[model samples]
Target: MAYLRLFDWYQTNKRDLPFRKTDNPYHIWVSEIMLQQTQVDTMLPFYDRFLTIYPTIQDLARADIDEILKVVQGIGYYRRFRMLHKGAQYVIDHHDGKLPEDYFKILKIPGIGAYTAGAIMSIAFHKPYPATDGNVIRVLSRVKMLEDDFRLDKNKKKLNEMNKELIENSNNPYLYTQSMMELGATVCKVSNPLCDTCPLQEVCLANINNVQQNYPKMSPLKTKKEIQYFTFILEYKEGFLMRKRTEDLLHGFYEFVQIESDSLNGALTQAQDLGLEIQILDELQPIKHVFTHMIWQINLYRGTISNITSPYEIVHDFSQVPIATVVKKQIKQI
Candidate 1:
């Protein structure tokens, strides 16, 4: 249908990305995983550094998880990096250091899901399967003007079926798959689309009906739950005290000595109970950080301790802590 024409157009117009030049499944898989929920511009440097350090699946599999986390420090979603490390080990140990060509086997890995598997299969293996990511979903929904919410099961099924048909009918499945993604990213954008230059504009229902921006209706997002955290930047003669968050939210990451409190006075009392000599150095302005489903209002406190026998351990170097950007910024300001 219209995707065939778009595919033809893409062969001449597609951007030259590093992953497109090689049929190496390891490289393709790594790029695909990093590309998820991360912009290409932001991922470029990280991808280069990652490939330089861990050139193969075996290298990544054998590398320490903490080292990998350190390399991918600011990218956020620390769990994805951990899962990638685990998945690499799984592939090497179970599949003999080679990525599995079979779709089901790939899906069995710790973090590889349907979309990632589909992408690797088509791009690396030249399979006819389509990668139904958010970009593909947007392109299809606007082309056919699907009214149902895409997040719902029924519409998702329909979109998957349509994506399969589109890929199966195309002569060059790899080019077609990449084309659909490129079209959505460059021309058929989420907000203000360049419909005039889109190859599918003639048949696109959204363009013909003049409702390109309104197609693919989305459900309202749930409001993020707000949490107030009192961060104590307790400094001794040698260094400052910090802790690694072991919880699921920011697991394996570092932060300042933090205590959840409803008010500032309560937080100070709690810190005093922990035997920390409460000396207020400075009360900085409140800092706000947002996660996927939560908002954090962190209040920073800088104080020095004469006695080094408190529960908090002193970190001599700031670079050792795998602190997120928000905490790092706060520390820098203090």
Candidate 2:
């Protein structure tokens, strides 16, 4: 009865997001993959552009990886896009471009995890599988007054069981899934939740006990390790020198020559070792870029040189280089 009430309330009061309008497995899978670590507002334009370019699984499967990367530029996590490309190809080759309706079969895709599989099952196939993302976890913890750490595997198992039960009893599984996410996003927010307007306020455990902030206990975050980097803008009469990053961190992206050192002098020596006659042009401002687990303190050094030769490609325009967001910003500022 309580679950039905929540579902009923959700039917009338859900946000109209683009992904919620259709049950197309392709659309749902794309949106779910894009929204992994990205916020809704940031993803809106990108999602529209992506769908416009490659509207079907076949289109994406046939497209080149470089072309796809160009479209998804400015969105972080390049590896996710690569995996998505692989997944699309798999769908096209194995499933004839039709996404599988079975939950377990869909989960077999490279990037599709439990949350994504659940979302596709409920929204696309109308199956009773719950998508337990961060928002849902927060809402469930607060509503149930769970004291255990939400990040633990034991708690995750319990939460998944609770979610499965909720879905099984839900009158409309699609609406129920979206409603839970909507409530967490709008009413039962992380901080300063609108408890007065919340539909579940009457029975919400967090609100009744006045411990909303304490119910969803989060694990302590690890400190970001900082590293100093010196990036050189090596310009000659013809073009600038840039190299492609071929490793896991930022593979397939282009950036200016970077040297890891504690001091600027050490970076200069390293540059000279690369067989380039270095002439210091101007010292631009230092830039700080933070990744998920790493912090980079980058110092920008510009110089004009002649007779520079290396494996790097020389491009006349800096913007044409496929640099990462952090390196792109640093180049723009210089």
Candidate 3:
């Protein structure tokens, strides 16, 4: 009955997202991957541009990683793109370029997990599969009024099983899954839920008791690790020297000459190691960047490099390179 009500509400209330316009599995897969830990509004432009570049799975499988990352650069979370690329290649090689409809087979793909695999199966293939995301988890927890910490593995596993059963029993699995997600995102939000507008308000235990926030119990956030870096825009004749990061955190992304130094003297010492006598033309204001697990305090400096090197790549055109967002912000300060 709740499913029916949610579906009815979704018929007119669903957001007209571009990904919802088609039943193509490839498109849906791309959208699902992009949607992970990313806001819909922020990813829309990037999704459109990404599809324009690699409209087909085959096209994506063949595109260079650099080219793919260039398009996905500003969107952040480069690892997702890398995984998408690997998944596309896997699909092409094994599944004949078509996304497998079988849930197990789809799960075997490099980037896809339980949620993504379920979404593609139900939405694109019209199969009975449940895709439980964070929003869906919240909705289910409140509907059942489960007091268990939803962040715990046992509770999450239980919710996934519950969702699977719900999907299996539903007459319209496709609409059921989508509508549930829509309801959670728009109506049954985590904080200050729109209980009056929610279709499940009457049936939801959390809503009836006015304890929506207390249902989906969350774990405390961990302390953000602090790190300090000295970034330099080593400008040569007409370009800045850039290097590809092979280290952990933002691995494989490009950035200006940088070193992990908290002080100017220490940064200068590291700069000398690179065989460059840098005259500090400008010392920009310090910039702070917060990642999921860490906080970066960056000191930015800009100066023309006295020595040109073969180890560094010269980038004159910013548009042509796929630079990390943190590095771009530092460059903008110069």
Candidate 4:
């Protein structure tokens, strides 16, 4: 409802994205999966590369897991790719190679959540549905001047319902979804919103009340757990030693042998107890990598190993392996 200005502005100002040019549900679904927890600019190349390789739901379903991971290695958050791969396969196996048009049916796919399902239905299927992402929440919360903490489930549901009504009234679901996304991303930005130029400035209560920054009230975030690890890259005659991580955070990826110790001496004692003797050649520069809830303060040190007993493999080349970005950073040091 009353989205003409927003739609007109989007037509003139929206960035030319590959996904925007197509109404194909498969393509849009791929884009939605990639865009989760990733910026458009960053996900663009990987999107292109992934499409070049997979090209269709069938291709994506049949492709090997390692190949899938290799294509999207540097994108961080490895689990997104894993789930996307499974979702595509689910489409092939269950939906007969077509992305479902029905909202509830599409959610059966492995990684398609409420927001993704809504996006697909509205944008690709041209059905009136609300895609209530963070941007939309911010925009709507500011417009209605709701001070309820959106972090809470009840407040979020309220915003989602409001957006649902707005989209239903628009009658042009595609433009309603895309235009809202564009407005939130480009104009009603988190900081320094361009209120004077915004199409919805008249409707935005926060802008009218001169409280643009305060409307979408949120609870404080949990503190990130910081951990110090003495990272090791011990080289034998074979190559560098790398451990296959089975931990949930970075599972099915390669990482250097790392021990949770603040000091090298402590790590060395631990290493000795494992029946491995490392001749420390030099201490390379340290690196820090931050995940969603945890931060790894990696103290990197590269050296040659004299004796070994713990199970690990020597990697001559790591190009094929699904190496995490943090491990890749340490790789750059050596």
Write down the TM-score of every candidate.
0.95, 0.95, 0.97, 0.96
| Candidate achieving the largest lDDT | 3
RMSD of 1: 1.6
Per-residue lDDT for 1-334 in model 4, tens only?
3488888888899999999988778889989988987888999999899899988888998899888888998887888878988998888888889987899998788988889999999999999888998889888888888989998989888888989999999979999999888888888898999999888888888989999999689999999999999988999777888778888877788887788997899998988887778888889998988888989998888888876564677878889688878988988887
Candidate 2 runs further than 4 Å off: 318-321
Give the lowest summed-lDDT range of ten residues in model 1.
304-313
Q: For residues 9-121, what per-residue lDDT tens digits would candidate 1 score against the true structure?
A: 78877888888888889999989889888877888888889999999998999999878887888887878888999999898789998988898898898888878888888
Q: What are the clash counts of all predictions, listed in order?
A: 0, 0, 0, 0
Model 2 agreement with the true structure over 218-322: per-residue lDDT tens digits:
799889999999988888666777887888887778777788999888887887798776788899988899999999999888887776666667878755545
In model 2, pairs of residues that clash are: none
- TM-score of model 2 vs. true structure: 0.95
Q: Which stretches of candidate 1 lie over 4 Å from their true place?
A: 307-311
- lDDT scores in order: 0.84, 0.84, 0.88, 0.87
lDDT of 2: 0.84
Model 4: lDDT equals 0.87
How much does candidate 3 score in TM-score? 0.97
